[model samples]
Target: MTVNFNARPLTKALIFRIQKQNMHYSNSKYWDFCAPVAGILLTLSFAPFDYSWLALAAMAFLFAAWRGCSAKRAALRGYLFGLGAFGSGVSWVYISMHDFGGAGALESSLLTAVFAAFWALFPALAGYLSVKMKGPGQVILTPVIWMLVEYLRGYWVLNGFPWLQLAYSQLETPLAGYIPVLGAYGAGFIAALTASIAVEICRGKKRLLLITALTILWGTGALLRNQTWTHEIGQPIRVSMIQGNIAQDQKWRPENKINTLLKYKRMTEEHWDSNVIIWPETAIPAYLDQVQDAFLAPLANDAKLHNTDLIISVPVQETAPVKNFNAVITLGKEQGMYRKTHLLPFGEYLPLQPLSGFVLDLINIRLGNFTPGTATQPLLKAGGYPFITLICYEDVFGDLSVRGLPDAAFLVNVTNDGWFGDSIEPHQHMQMARMRAIETGRFLLRSTNTGMTGIVSSKGEIVGQAPLFQETALTGTINPMGGMTPYARWGDRPVIGLMVVLLLGLLGYGKVNVGRISVTAV
Candidate 1:
């Protein structure tokens, strides 16, 4: 199916060509795209939907199989391939919007299609750009394109959704060390690069050195995961993470706050033996100043007297009247607080007040307008440990925790997922957290308001966790760890910078040797 670039609008031949291309792709005209199209569709099943590494590897092979006819052809195939990948990857969004998001099947499907289309564009752009930038002599430009597109995915539209990002491949993988340095996006960039490298190697391309180089890099990460990144400087400490599976609707109700606090107190009372005890997002709903002054006064005094440290979450007001989020403090000996910088779109804050009623009506829920917190200094000290803190969905954002509090100790992430309720969304959330722990090399202690609480060491190992939708205290000892992962220190700058260099490097190489490559049937 060929597209005529010179066609005028409303021309019969132009309309016929459009119809021809559509029919070619969907029916039988464009058999050339069938393999790549199938390969792309196959990738959707490889995601969390099935969790198969073999499937991922196969997609890589298939993508390489049907690639490199011409620059325009490559881009078109890539676009078609991505349509298949994202169309299936985010099919669950339909469940979220229909089952949980309160939309009918058709409405949800349309919304999901729009979302998938946006995601597919990134990969399409990557494919097109790779060919455009690919060097003539032994080039692996697919990875370069992938990294750039992934970087684009991280921005655009309320900060791009890195969901289904390539980093998740390392969630349960041994390539954990790369995460701490490159961040998930960084790791993803490497993964895409490696896949393209593998493709080039398969094509009998020169050197085959990049494949070996990538292997050695990740092999080093595997060996290094067992090594402790940070030395212990503080005395031993313990923490009790309480998971209250309270429904989101009932969590902040005036009457329910009492039960919520009581539930945490009861579940955690026995664990007071631990040096530090933490609760999930808004485990206590009242603000700092609004707290029964008498209650907190005694609570703080007792924690100090008992030689304990307490870090808890509660919505606190910012200025005299404005309310920014404050998962405020009751730290023992020295008290400090962390305000969540990034707030959830609908859950914590409502945007465009004129449409507030319309949005709430769409979801069948009340929406709050929570303000963003100042770049509050790191408040990581607790029972002698210093760490960085992020509340709720904040853990999903890349570099925010590391950049916001670089040079801190480990990571402390508090979240409440009762709202998602028995959905795969929570598991998706957990997968992202695990990648973060790996990328930063800092011990990640995640305490969820409802469940999926755990400890992730610098090596990305999950040493402890509580199951979802339960009320209980998960007590565990964790290292107050710190270390500079490549990503932690440089983020994706290295990946992007290198890609730019490669683009320039390839121009000369392509000019010198691409004729030979074309002759060889690439």
Candidate 2:
């Protein structure tokens, strides 16, 4: 008698045991403990750490935690994950609130917590919706839902905070190739999709198909990197960026104001041979009307004498409604003024009226009450070429950065990162600025107060950078670029519209399939 040893049943039993074990753990306290740790892992994927690959693993961990869970449980896990991510990632808010906003350490901590918790709700909503929309095509549905919620968080709520976006973390990866074609949000969707597929593969679902899909997605991105989206239009021009390294607390002091002006002026005079010179945000530390004649006129004359354009940032007090604008003005060889359109909600202006006022007053945190500038303002000219100007926080918005593109030859961002002190905020800010360069295929000349002043190439690589916390002149040459990247042409609309359609299609398909199965069973 020949005994046939059937190994298929034994293999099936082993696989079933493993899956059951996974399900039990996923529904237990283990997932709750793992959620926040996964968030920290996500934070580590960003600047100052830059473990980009960890981003995939981090999201996979969160997805696993959400799998086989109810919507409420998933939301809780997501909220915990967000608390960990934002708490560690943007704790620099504490530095700004305590060090600059005049809030006590304890008060700053509480306010910072509140800020993180509030933003965490976006992820919670994503988790809740993901579970509600779960179906046979959940691998695709989960990532689409996640990115849609990220869009709401980054563009809509409270004037938007686009920081800590997953796309920014993938700047060094092949996924960055997607930026020019799809912009930041689209790239983020790809990243989220990659992570979602990875989670499903681990669950032993459509392993071969998911693997092939990932290979195609990543391979296509790698190929896209070699494609030229924008080209140089003019000769390389010498540019100088002066980092004033001005202390936030002392910047507005009456006595230090003159020294600040003189410091930047002295630095500019040294680099006058350059085609263009840039000063960081509010480098003048005073209203434009106050210094137009006494300081700016002579400086403009000197810049003209040296055959260079001087681009500087100063607060402009406008009359009609007595509104104050954070403005950038170009002088010397060219003349133009671009007022900042996007304002940092709490930092530049308060929202929610009396309620926000009362809360801020309770913390004794008095912020600027500046008004936003018009969006249709003309582009500023420097080095005899038109350029887009992003004042401080404006560069974080990818859509905002591309508004003047194709026409604008390069990008100039004037920022004062000193408010966050010697923290990761400057590094993160510089990282996002580099993404803008890649998205628009324009050289980005980023001038910052107190750190990370640098010239970013169209490929998102650093051409030249200054040491953090140093007062020095960073000199680099950039060729003015003229051409339209797909992102520059259509902005985020195409990607957003595509996401919305995919979500709706998946929901419709799932319903139809469910209906057919129910009728057949009956």
Which one is best on lDDT? 2
Model 2 gets an lDDT of: 0.90
lDDT per residue for candidate 1 within 8-95, as digits (tens), equals: 3334465467657654433332533554455354444333454535434644653463353445555566556666666755566666
In model 2, the runs with Cα more than 4 Å from the true position are 1-23, 518-522
Model 2 per-residue lDDT tens digits across residues 92-211: 999999999999999999989999999888878889999888766889899999999999999998898988889999999889899999999999999999999999899798899999
Off by over 4 Å in 1: 1-52, 55-62, 69-109, 134-139, 155-157, 204-228, 286-288, 292-295, 319-321, 326-328, 346-366, 404-407, 508-522
Candidate 1 versus the native: TM-score?
0.80
lDDT of 2 at 199: 92
Clashes of 2: 0
Cα displacement (Å) at residue 358, model 2: 0.8
Candidate 1 residue pairs that clash: 136-510, 179-439, 180-439, 180-440, 181-485, 181-486, 181-487, 182-487
What lDDT, from 0 to 1, does candidate 1 have?
Answer: 0.66
What are the candidates' C-alpha RMSDs? 7.2, 5.7
